[model samples]
Target: MFDWRWDFVAEIMPRLLWATGNTLMAAGIGYVIALVLGLFLALGQRGSNRVLTTILREGIEFIRSTPLILQIFFVFYVGPQFGLVLSPWVAGMIAIGLHYSCYLSEVYRGGIESVPRGQWEAATALNMTRWQTYKQVIIPQSLPFALAGMGNYLVGIFKDTPMLSVIGVYELVHTANAIGSENYRFLEPYTLVGFIFLAISLPTAALVRLFEGRVRSKMGMN
Candidate 1:
């Protein structure tokens, strides 16, 4: 009852590969957004404005507590009611980016807190601006601590991109589902998707670990 067809695999390969590119684009754009926004969120929490910090903390908590699929659906579906409709790609990216940004903010907070208080004192002693303190000293030191979490979310966003399919973004899982529906061969298409994900994720995780070590060594934290 097990029949594997190489021809079917070959036929669908091109479409899947094309979709893979879209998936990577989605993940890359979302990750960039999350990375920058998460940093701002983390800094906001530590900033002088108590009200803003409280709001940002609550926002992050709310996002972290919800399911990402619900977020994606809300952005894509509910926005039209408020006159802020976005395309599938834009909506998916924003939803994924915002969802992951909350998690990454926590990672950044931990990293920032790990910096010794003496470092802040030293920055003050050296007449460094707040910007200079974070840019030159705190951030560089926190990077190694943050890198592992950042990398995990990089992969997490990639995995979660499939949820975008519900909104009609033509990413890998969507393509595979299309192929399966057309041919009624879920086996090959789904298995191939798994292989493709594994192919990407394994190498990325290894590189993250490698980069973490290099960063720590350079920062003399090794």
Candidate 2:
């Protein structure tokens, strides 16, 4: 029987906890970038110019079509070849933000489209400019729809943070790998890593569900 090393676990616990802070920071920054950039992409898609709309649509489609891992590799490695020298954290956040922005842009598009056409017509009849109409009428009503989708991506980002380890971001999973390698005790480190993920994700998932319910209720959909 393989004996458990309690001493090793105790020693690694602090390191794992410390690394989790980095993970959370990365996730937080990545989410912020995704949110801001996503709104822009969505607005671009819905802009007045046909060329901008086409470009936005194609750009989003290309991002959604590609695997995120390759995107990370490309941004971290290939980008430097072209004179873009991004740190691992910056590259990871940018990659994640860009990839997820494509998805959230679709969410924003759906939200904007879901607003009643009559609202637009009413604003136009009132001599409201297009920007004014969108700002004062369309966006407020569509916010709830966007919120639900945004919440989903927040959860998605949390789950995908492990991928950042590949770029040398030193998140929780990366720390776990280091501990396991040093001690050659794969079982404890991997198992603890899974538990850590579950502890963080399950609660976050519940919050998303609660927020989704609130949004639906507020939108009169529930």
Candidate 3:
């Protein structure tokens, strides 16, 4: 009792493609937030203030342990009760970004630790302040190490964008579901979505690997 219809695929292609754009946009926004905030989180864990470091570490661990959907619901549903009302888009982005920031902080910490101890000693010998040492030397060297992990998460966030549908985001899956409900046919739309994801994810993953190689080479990390 299964049938595939090319006509239905064509009829729905435009709307599906439009929703795909929204999906990409959501991923991009969330990724940028994670990139910036994750660095700060990684650094906070290394600070001299023991209490602050412990609290920050615990908070990051808590976020990492919980489900992202729970975080999304908490931000969207619970925040309104606390006078932190936000739109679905805002709530989704904040939740996704914050969730990934914790994961990325671990990645960043690993990258930072990969740098040679001598590098820090050399910076200290030059009388560089902590900020200057991190900004000028450590960050540049650590970035290549982090690049692979960063690329992985970039693809990860893209894949996870579908979770936004639970919060009413009009992303690809959400649109596909709507189209299927309207036509009473899920076969075509859902199949198209799978192929679309395959088409996008394959190339994106390849590009990330390619970009990582280039960054490594440019940093003389090859």
Question: Per-residue CA lDDT of candidate 2, range 1-222, in tens?
Answer: 367777877889899988888888888888888878988998888778999899889988999999998899989998889998999998999899899988888888899999989999999999999889989999888888788788888888888889999989999889988988888888778877888888988898889889878877977985
lDDT of 1 by residue, 82-136 (tens): 9988999999999999999999999999999999999999999999999999999
Per model, state how many residue pairs clash. 0, 0, 0
Determine the C-alpha RMSD for candidate 2 after optimal superposition of all C-alphas.
1.7
Predict model 3's lDDT versus the native. 0.93
Q: Which stretches of candidate 2 lie over 4 Å from their true place?
A: 1-3
Taking every candidate in turn, the Cα RMSD to the unseen true structure, in Å, is 1.1, 1.7, 1.3
The estimated TM-scores of all candidates read 0.97, 0.93, 0.96
**What's the TM for model 3?**
0.96
Q: Which 10-residue window of candidate 1 scores lowest in summed lDDT?
A: 1-10
Q: Which segments of model 3 are wrong by more than 4 Å? A: none
TM-score of 1: 0.97
Cα lDDT of all candidates, in order? 0.93, 0.87, 0.93
lDDT by residue for model 3 over 21-81, one digit each (tens)?
9999999999999999999999999889999999989999999999998999889999889
Q: Please list all clashing residue pairs in model 2, or write none if there are none.
A: none
